[model samples]
Target: MKYTEILEVVRQYIEQFYDAKEDSTLTFHNFAHTHDVVTHATKMAKHYGLDERETFVVTTASWFHDTGYYTGEANGHEQRGAEMAGGFLKNLGVKEELIQEVQKCIMATVMPQKPENLLQQIMCDADLYHFGTEQFSERNMLMQEEVERKTGCKIDNNNWRKATICLLESHFFKTGYGRELLEYGKKKNLERLKRKETRGMMRKSHIPNSCLGE
Candidate 1:
């Protein structure tokens, strides 16, 4: 089956299986995020001259990256996504060997889990492209919301800022293209952090009595 056909099947599965009304995992793991990952993954794969087989496998993995969210498992979502991907691809007449490759790509995206192959590395970087993009602020907010909503973790301003800073500090790009092109965006994120710290200081400097005209 063609990639377009496989994507359509994945879309249908997300719509039919993902319960948007649910307040847990399915709430924020929407189709738009999947589409964004796939778009970036495709672009990166093409730019890097990935073979067609690798491209198809990586793109399929991208489409199913968040499938575990629908299953309500936070930690093993990559494995769940891989399982779902295998089934979806099999239905699309994808060969057994290619399906395994796609599954490997899916599993390679798990956080704290290192990618074992080049295709995996590419998809992993593509998954995190937004972190080094101009829209990183807004994208990070969505992720925080998803985590808070799903896990009931209340992230205060201080903790959120600290976590964002740490992520920016530790993030490493897998592809040279991503590193070269996305450096400016990462700098912007750093600047955003500095501005946040400055704003906090300014707020602290203000006197409540001044506002009351004491």
Candidate 2:
């Protein structure tokens, strides 16, 4: 089958897979997030003028990169996702070479993303594209909500901000396109978060000791 046909099949399969196993706790890593990653991957692929086969590899990987979230564990979702992609593609008669490429792309999205090639770098940047966009705030909140819901613990707002700031500070866009187009926006978002954290601390400092039962 053509790569386009194969990609369409993968898309449908992933959609159905998520639909069949609905989990409300997956506020962030659901079909919507997968679709967004695919969209961002496509955009970056196009920016780099990737050929049809390369585009297919990156796009297909995006579709399956988070499938393992459905398996009820986020710890090693990237490995599980790569396995799922390989198995599904193998069943579809995809060549072993292409299947491995797709698996590599998916694995590149693992935390502290370590992408060794351009395609892997595209996948990594696409997965965290929101971190550099205007949608960062909304996406970040959904992720926070998902984490709290899954762990059954209310994360303190100040602590969440601190963690988010650390992430923003540590993250860098791997692709040139990402650095050129998204880096400024990411810095702006980081500044906004820092300001919020500062205001939060100031507010707490102004509170009376009596209110703290001291």
Candidate 3:
């Protein structure tokens, strides 16, 4: 099949998979997030001048990267996603080499992401693209909701903000376009979160001992 046709098939399969395995708890890792990542990957691929085959690999990987969330537990979701993507592509008669590349791209999205090549770097950046977009606040809330629902615990807002700040500070965009286009927005988001955290602390400190119900 043509690369375009293959990509269409992958898209359809992933959409249907999400539909069939719908989990309301996965507010942040749903099909919408996958589509966003695919869009980002496509944009990055074009900017980097990836050929048809390379684009296909990255695009397909984006579509299936978080699918493991539906298939099993969140831990090692990347590995599960890679296996699922590999199996589906193998059935479609995709070449073994290309299939491996797709799996590698998906795996590269794991936290503390270690991408060995430009393609993998694109995948990593695309997965976290929202971190640098205006949607960061909304997406971050949804992610926190998903985590709280899955774990059955209320996350402390101050701690959550701290963790998010740590992530924003630690992560760096790998591709040139990503660094140039995303860094400023990411810094803005980080500052916003830090300010919120500070205000939350101040609010708590100003509350009287009797008001605190002690």
Candidate 4:
């Protein structure tokens, strides 16, 4: 099979797997999210003038990146996803070096992301493409729902707002196109988060003393 064909194979495989394993609770990591990330990665790769082989590597890595969620392990999904990618590419007769690049791309997407190279940086940015876009709020709500369903833990609105604000303030997009497309929107999102936090605090302070802790 051509290396080119592998992308389609991967795309079909993940869609089928997700269909078989669909969980409404996993709103954030479902097939739609996967497709969106891959699409964003593809666009960035094209913008950055990735050759065909580089495109294949980045896009294939994007395909398998989130699949470890199938194993129900949230903590090490990157390693699990890399292992899965390695096995799949091996069966496809992909080169050891190419497979390693793909694995590295997968691993580079882990939170507090540290992407060492251009391709890995694209993977990281694509994985977090939503963070700097108008869709951040809607996508975050999906993630919140998934977390609540899985962990049965409730993070109060104030805490969630504070955490999100911190994340948006600290995050940066690495590539030129990444920053071009996302940085301004991310700034706006941060301001919106701050405003929302302020409103929440004001509402809390306005609550009558009867509900306050003694």
RMSD, each candidate, Å?
4.1, 1.1, 1.4, 1.3
lDDT of 4: 0.89
Error of 4 at 20 (Å): 1.7
Query: By lDDT, is 1 or 4 better?
Result: 4
lDDT of 1 by residue, 34-113 (tens): 77888899898889898766787888788788878767567888888888888877877889999898888888777754
Residue lDDT tens for model 4, 1-214? 4756788888888889889988777879888999998999999998889998999989999999999998766889889989999998898788999999999999998888899999999999999999889999999888888888888898787788888888888889978888998999999988998999889889988988888874
Task: State how far residue 56 of model 4 sits from its true place (Å).
Answer: 0.6
Residue-level lDDT for 15 in candidate 1: 60
Q: How are the candidates ranked when ordered by lDDT, highest leading? A: 3, 2, 4, 1
**Model 1 error, position 128 (Å):** 0.9
Q: List TM-scores for all candidates, in order.
A: 0.82, 0.97, 0.96, 0.95
Candidate closer to the true structure by TM-score (higher is better), 1 or 3: 3
The 10 consecutive residues of candidate 1 with the worst lDDT sum are 19-28
Report lDDT (Cα) of residue 7, candidate 3.
98
Per-prediction backbone clash count: 0, 0, 0, 0
Candidate 1: segments with Cα more than 4 A from true spot: 1-28, 201-214
Rank order by TM-score, top first?
Answer: 2, 3, 4, 1
The CA lDDT at 129 in model 4 is: 91
Residue pairs of candidate 1 with colliding backbone atoms: none
Q: How does residue 32 of candidate 1 score in lDDT?
A: 68
